[model samples]
Target: MSSTTMEASAALDGFHPITRQWFTEAFPEPTRAQTLAWPAIAAGRSTLLLAPTGSGKTLAAFLVAIDRIMFGLPEPTLSENKPGVRVLYISPLKALGVDVERNLRAPLAGVRAVAQREGVPFHEPQVGVRSGDTPAAERTRLNRQPPEILITTPESLYLILTSRSRDILRDVDTVIVDEIHSLVATKRGTHLFLSLERLERLRREDDPQRRPLQRIGLSATQRPLDEVARLLGGAEADANPEQPVRPRPVEIVEAGRSKQIAVTIEVPVEDMTQLAQPVVTGSAAGAPQPASIWPAIHPRLVELIRGHRSTMIFVNSRRLAERLAAAINELAEEELALAHHGSIAKDTRLVIEDRLKLGQLPAIVATSSMELGIDMGAVDLVVQIEAPPSIASGLQR
Candidate 1:
């Protein structure tokens, strides 16, 4: 092998043979983010990884944790004494959390397949999700026999810490917070930080000598990296009375530069004033209703959907999403689109997401609910009906 090839392979040396084999076969090579992050994470550093969407940033954060659970442990199988949760993944959005849970299945199964083929013992780690959407029975089951990895949201984590579920988190050594940018600037961010501090106290109360939690934060869009780093690494007071408190140490990995975006602006009417023209109909004589701009917009959306393999339409509200989706399907003369927003049932939204991923649906009209890091497989076109809520929100789309 060439020197460069040898160097790249060295990065995977810390992982188990089964993990390394499965990864090599699954992906051509480690992404830039993964190459830079695995070493720091394996060395047990709290790290904040910045990378663009679809750059394998999620796998960079997850693969090592999975390896540790499978191979680094003294026993391959979970014993009665070692059954507590070991890794905690926190996502800001419920859809993103659910997407992550579905995505993890591939890697877990890949590694397990490698082990079985080689006649090696494989310990399949269980994963559990706890959120408002989780059924009561499922929550009780999770509490009784906690999974090795727990995926949750900020509010759910706070609730877990406050209730009896907190016990399941006592042995958690690693916390992976996805989409860190969304949570660093608002009251929600403040609440999550407070919860992190509380979790630290809970861990220490369980075992005072245990090492501090290892936090790994992932974000595709952020500014003034230092500020986000400071938040990721919470504050600690110095021993000296006069000195100000300092933030904990956190390693920053920069890779995956944002792709240059192309924009096009189109309008249905030649003159802006034409949009306000009143609709005249034979049956409606009581009042003159302004004409709808949607009639003009729906056809263009259908045309775009036909042109692209997959398209995502972002609107400002749920009502618009539903209307736009139905209009597009009617205009296309087929069920070519689906609406995804907070108001939709969780199971229904999941089915829509699956259909889009499988290329069964050509388009999905969504609101801020799809603005986070949910993986939309093969979606190459994004149409924004109105301006996004903010610049960060737009970038997420």
Candidate 2:
């Protein structure tokens, strides 16, 4: 034990008593990202949290919003959610949005239950998800009784912001952008920022008393982070030609250096040439994998899967994802693993995602599609056929 450990309980005093208790129970102590993120976000500052995977950045943003919605909103008299959305969470992937909703249930249920037992008046916040996969009837339900927390992909959000249903977002006060790095590197990200800007404008114009949207961006990997921070929510910096360019008023919590990755190399059997041939060593590396070594590899993969609760096998292409998944399941008594790529039907993909998260599936062989921040519970191991395109990507996986 250290001085920091000794005083951990006192540090959470600023949070609502129920939230503080839940925080202490769920997380033994605050993660570094949490320590930095909560204070800034609690103070209503736009924040960019750059931490590696499993650092709890999503919860850092979410918990603050949850606290506000439950107890910290500007309106002291209001206990329940307002007419429109209160917190809108945007992700690049529909699957990621669904994944976040699953993770939120634990905290929502726990915190609300604790609040109730403590004789605290509690207003259970409703959470709804909208994406391309959402059925028309479900979409209508969300509009009729909008949830306080809405999880959505960029495209779905854009549609919501632009549609007649835009009024549903008029009260949105907090917007969390997860996997911010994935969006900022492309034109799609540009479109997302525009949507965010539009949503902000709606909040501002809808009511003069409405609080400014508190934006929080979470990323596993980012470079030129200041630019991303500005895009996350910061207004353009002042045009003081004489002074050095100052970053906008966004609090950046970067703990990328603190993460440590221990990588282990495991070969099924020592000499691969005995099992397959020279092709395993050369010529078929990044392109098409050699058919020869797959037979030996699949059984080892099945063995590895049997040893783990859940596994995520990342391959270079969808074709390879299908082949590898089929190969691995062929060795099993029944289909224990499934292939997931962009080409899969949206409903099917959601089912596979749910099954994987619920521990119903042994493993999923996926392409880069699964690489984004979808909370598929815990994966015992990740198998990569080739090194990811970049260090950032590899870290995210």
Candidate 3:
């Protein structure tokens, strides 16, 4: 009824009927990011959506791609009318890719339900995850029957681009990069940018008339967004030989920039300078000093865990994660918390993640592995053992 409500409703006009119905039924209204992002993406433009966490930025990038796959027409070049992947989702973390794949099931199923109820045609979208953790057999199956939406990490995407698997990506029209800040300054980011260029080349070779890939980048914290926008859109070859290449056009959507963050710094120890035990009589000068603060820290951690529904404790290394979890269990006399890090087996890590999401686990001692945009459900409390490696890392946790 209001003007803002009217604009939000108008943004959904470009989506498929089933998608719109399912979305309207599932959510009361779209987030600010979604309201601005859908229109640009629906218009086949590259988009960089900057918004705070929990602002539905992921869904803002995903829903438009899902709608296109469900109702859009297949490329004329398909040999036997078999559709290959059309949406490529790149995440810096494998866990985040897997999480996105899992999260997509609800929306896909919801849209399918809407179509079935209305007795209309519906193409069930298939989503797949390809990462180092993917088994050989699973990878083979994915190649044999490519999903409409493919989720992968930058490293995995590079591998796919180099190998024969790249053929399956010739029809991809959309690329969604998650956590753009993590990759913008790293070798991995450069590798991913080169891989995207490779992907563009592959698509052009397949069909010279096809349009350039539509890029969508999602990030919560990124400074000098102009620089990131150039990376997302890359560059385009200019028609005139006298001129240098120009940056591709991209739409920027910044929404929900102001968010409420409650931070409390708690020190359990009474004395600041006496945080460590007195120097041992026979210890060497550089010997590992025992942290007396931890003795007081453990009980406080337990009390906080018991008070909160779910908690994530982040440390800098895997060793610290193990030590913290062991200490917490030793004090609690139960397996109230588990350690999660890269060193842990993939199956075990997934079990821990699932447990935390289902409210079966009260706390997790994790390294940077858990700091990304993995949807940890109902995480009301987060404890960082020390200052994070960077501001971006701290914000991610």
State which candidate has the highest lDDT: 3
Worst ten-residue run, lDDT, model 3? 74-83
- The candidate that wins on TM-score is 3
Candidate 2 residue lDDT tens string, 1-397: 7776644444466588899888888777987777767778888888999887777888888988888778664442223453678889988887788778988999899899889889898677899999888899999999988888999989999898889899888777788998998889789999998888787677667365555678889998888888998888644333587766543477788867564556777675567666443234456555544446566678888988999999998888889999988888778867878999878988899899888888899899998789987776568788877677767677778
Please list all clashing residue pairs in model 3, or write none if there are none. none
TM-score of 1: 0.91
By lDDT rank, best first, the candidates go 3, 1, 2
Off by over 4 Å in 3: 238-242, 275-278, 281-292
TM-score of each: 0.91, 0.82, 0.93
lDDT comparing candidate 1 with the true structure: 0.87
Cα lDDT for residue 353, model 2? Answer: 85
Q: Alpha carbon lDDT of residue 79, candidate 1?
A: 50
> Candidate 3 lDDT, tens digit per residue, 114-149?
988999886777899999999999999998888889
**C-alpha displacement of 360 in model 3, angstroms?**
1.5
